[model samples]
Target chain A: MIAFESVGKTYPDGTVAVADFDLEIASHESVVLVGTSGSGKTTLMRMVNRMVDPTQGRVTIDGEDVAATDPVALRRSVGYVMQASGLLPHRTVLDNIATVPVLRGTGKAQAHERAAELMEVVGLEESMASRYPSQLSGGQQQRVGVARALAADPNILLMDEPFGAVDPIVRAELQTELLRLQRELRKTIVFVTHDIDEAFLVGDRVVILKPGGHIAQIGTPEQILAEPADDFVRSFVGADRAERRLHLQQVAGREVVVDASGRAAGVLEQGGTP
Target chain B: MSWVSANLDTIAEQLLAHIAQALPAIVLAFVLALPIAKLANARGWLRGGLTGTAGLLYAIPSLPLFIVLPLMLGTSIRSPVNIVVALTIYGLALMVPSASEALRAVSRETLQAATAQGYAPWARFWRVELPLAGPALVAGLRVVVVSTVSLVTVGGVLGVPSLGMLFIDGFQRNITAEILTGIVLTAALALLLDALVVLGGRLALPWASGRAPRRRTAPRDTGQEAAR
Candidate 1:
């Protein structure tokens, strides 16, 4: 769980990035933050991992004020994925994924063992581990980025538009992979994106950010799609609210019958992801 | 001209003499530059000071550096020690920025990834930073070497009879063949050294292969987004 209390940030040059932003994230929850550029959504996310200290107010993860913790230590205690895939171009794929665990003081052998496990989770081939980020496709590099973030096995993961840099097809695939990973790992995730469909797809709680760092709406994707809180929320969510709803909705009649354990029985062809 | 061109055995002997003289000094230059480059790139206090110092050294003109350093070091005019110290200083002048800028230009995100992944600072430098910085470092080396070849001619003024001596002697004596031979050989050797750096860069940094021809999106991170 993460909490941001009255967080604000203003640069020395008089540019205000965030003003009095407050947010609470529940444990094991996937919260998607949607905003236009400079809405302070990413700044809010960085606060949880302590990458950027808040100029005002406090950010706590699981009730511990991150300011009290070493920013590096705090970061290791949480996960962070970036859009650039920020794969150290110098390191091989395996080494890049293993970076955090090693930094956390895990032995090389153990760190690599964990890295291989994560590479599998993110769908990276073992053979590709020896290659550098430069050698990878955009999608593959992002998977390594995800693996690297999870390397330390942090309780929470902060992803800043993790899939934004890849081609659309790869982006969609990564989005699906992310959802699947979240289901399995269940680490609390703060996903930031500008795309409405992405926020809808992965967020258990979708928080739409207003232009000036205030919350426009915070609710389940269903709630926001069915009833936006105000004009800003509706406009920000875009005019295709009905179509976006289709991606979130499930019709009972069209549902695929599954075993009691919820394993997939077959495709629910009658109803799509909506 | 005859000493270099007449006999295959003699040319080989001259080359061996040249390498014996050049190799240790070149290796020392790389060793010296690594740390200076790193310091210049990473340390805020060192950047300007190192840059300023190096620019001053670079502008000193090689002949003066060789002349001045020998007197400054209290060495005889013809000492190889003076020759090397001058060359090493000149190498650092160029290599410091080469290494630093190479390291600086490495994606900050990649470094964040390294640190986030729990890599200690030193480990990150070795495993991540150095490899990315390799191309630029080699580029710096190329500049150092070609200039060293030219500067060695200045050392000839100090009475060290190498190819540089041949050129300086040729210039004063107005012997076209000898001067031309030295100049031609120096250029040829400089090219050879450059080729070696490129080869070594490719070999040592196989991971640096391929230039992503695609235009990367100028990663648009809003003030909030940029922090992560």
Candidate 2:
């Protein structure tokens, strides 16, 4: 469990990034903080790993204050994925994945063995183990980034717009892969993204933020879609958009689900009527 | 042609002396420049101060430096140490700025990623920052190598023996062939050393040697492509 106790961050130059933000993330839950730029989603997520220390309050993991821990050791214990897929361009894929474990004092051979296994876990080929990051495609490089993040088998994963740089198809593929990995691994995940649809797809609960890290709304995607807390939430989530107005229509003797735009989304199953 | 054949032993001795002076100076300057450049890169004021000093040091003429340095070091006026020391200073003047720029060219994203992945500062420098800066550093080093080799000839004006002796003797005796030999051999030596530096860079930093393949393709079964 991770808890942010009235966490606030004000830069030395007097820019308030997050102001009195409070949230508790339960164990094994995937929470996505979705907001526009300057809303402090990335800043809040970084607070969990001590990347950004709060000026006015504290962040604790599993009832222990993160402030007392060494930042380097705390970072080694958690996984971080970011927008640019920041694999070391000079290191081979295997060596990049082995970075954390080696830093934590694991023997080179053992660390590499774990890295090779993680490559398979993250859907990378064995042949890619020896190739430098520059040789890989954008999607493949993201997979390597994911593998490197998972190298230490961390209990918590912090992903800040990890799929933002890839093409839409590859982004969707990576999203699906994350969902599958979450189902099996069950790590506590704090995901930050500006894409609401991505938040709905990957998060167990979505946090919609206004500027200065103020929460506009927080609920499961269904709850937020059904009853937006205010005008801001409604507009941010596009609850009034044509796409949200989905309905069933008869097409070729089968019931099909269509959006208000008349685009067919999927076929309605026969036996699963509510 | 008879003059060349007769002075073969002298030519060989001078060529060896030229290489001995040039090589050590090239190496020492590079070794010293890295840490100095790293220091200069740390802050704006330090960068300005250090590189500004190096640039001013480079502006002093070689013959004057060769003469002035012996007084400061208490070495003999004609000692080869004066040439080596003077050339090393010249090499540093060229190397420090380029090395600082090379280190700066490494992307911030990569450095932040290393930090997030639990790399200590020293580890990050050796593992990530240095290797990524390899191509640029090699380019800087080639400049140092060529210039160091060429500058060793200036020591001959101080009565030090090197390939430069041929030019001095040729000028006084009116043998144009000896002067031509000095110029040709000096240029050849510079080119030869420059080639070796390039070859060494290619061997050490194989990842930086070729154009990065932009599009993804199916993985190859063999590692031969990477070896290239």
- Highest DockQ scorer: 2
- Model 2 ranges with Cα > 4 A deviation: A249-256, A270-274, B211-228
Look at candidate 2 and tell me the lDDT of residue B108.
Answer: 94
Tell me how far candidate 1 lies from the true structure as C-alpha RMSD in angstroms: 7.5
Q: How many residue pairs of model 2 clash at the backbone?
A: 0
lDDT of 2 by residue, B92-183 (tens): 99999989999999999899888888787898899889889999999999999999998999889888999998898899899988998888
- Which prediction has the highest TM-score against the true structure? 2
Computed on C-alpha atoms, the DockQ of candidate 1 is 0.26
* lDDT by residue for model 1 (B1-228), tens: 564466446334444545555656667887788887787766798898888888887787767667777778998877777777877777778777777787788878777766665555787788778877778878888888877766666666777655676667778988777677777877888889889988898888776657533324343212322222
Regions of candidate 1 where Cα sits further than 4 Å from its true position? A239-274, B1-56, B120-123, B166-192, B211-228
Each predicted model: what fraction of the native A–B Cα contacts (within 8 Å) does it retain? 0.36, 0.39
DockQ of each: 0.26, 0.34
